[model samples]
Target: MTISGSCFCGAVTYKIEGKLRDARSCHCSMCRKAFSAQASAYALVEQSEFRWLSGEKLLTNYESKHGAGLQFCSKCGSTLCGTYKGMIHGVTLGCVDGNPDIALDRHIFVGSKALWETVPEGVPQYEELPPENA
Candidate 1:
């Protein structure tokens, strides 16, 4: 399935040629600050399947000391996607143009989550990452 998304101002657009997986909401402080939200909802995609569709020059990136790279639109400051060591890590679900047929299957880092942020019932929660085999 091909997925499309863009920044708020349409300054940066992207296409993912394959399906997304490992959907999750990250509640760690770094994620909260990176997304400017209580948490960040995202799904991982292969770098080979991801590409910029337009306005690539308008994308500004920031790489954390831990090597997590985030891409934002310089025009609207919208968080578009995440990276690791210059490779595509995942796309922010909020930026997707339409429903991506996926939902957060895991709520991670609840131990470091904001006190006011309550994860809804039924979704799996973890203080950190789930067991690698989970």
Candidate 2:
């Protein structure tokens, strides 16, 4: 299925051409700080399958520590999505056009989650990272 999404100011839009790989919430400090929210939820999309449909120039990028990059809209400063090491791409769940038929599979970096937060029910939670190394 093809999924579409846009930034908060509608300055950037994109489309993904297949089912996502893994959909989950991330509670890592970087995610929290980047989003300024309790957590961030995203779905993985292959670099080749993801396409920028509009406003390419409006997309701005930030390189956080460890060389990880977060992509957002320059106009509204909305945290639209991100790419890791310039390879795989992921889109924030909130930016998707409608409800994606997916569920939060796990919580990553639970060890770095805010002290006041509690893990949501039913999802497998990981202390530092996903089980897979790469």
Write down the lDDT of every candidate, Cα atoms only. Answer: 0.91, 0.84
Clashes of each: 0, 0
TM-score of candidate 2 on Cα atoms, chains taken together: 0.93
Off by over 4 Å in 1: none
- The most accurate candidate by TM-score is 1
Candidate 1: minimum summed lDDT over ten consecutive residues — where? 125-134
State TM-scores per candidate: 0.95, 0.93
Q: Which pairs of residues collide in candidate 1?
A: none
Per-residue lDDT tens digits for candidate 1, residues 1-134, read: 98999999987999999999999999999999988899999999989999999999998989988798899999999999999988889999999999798888999989999999888889999998898834
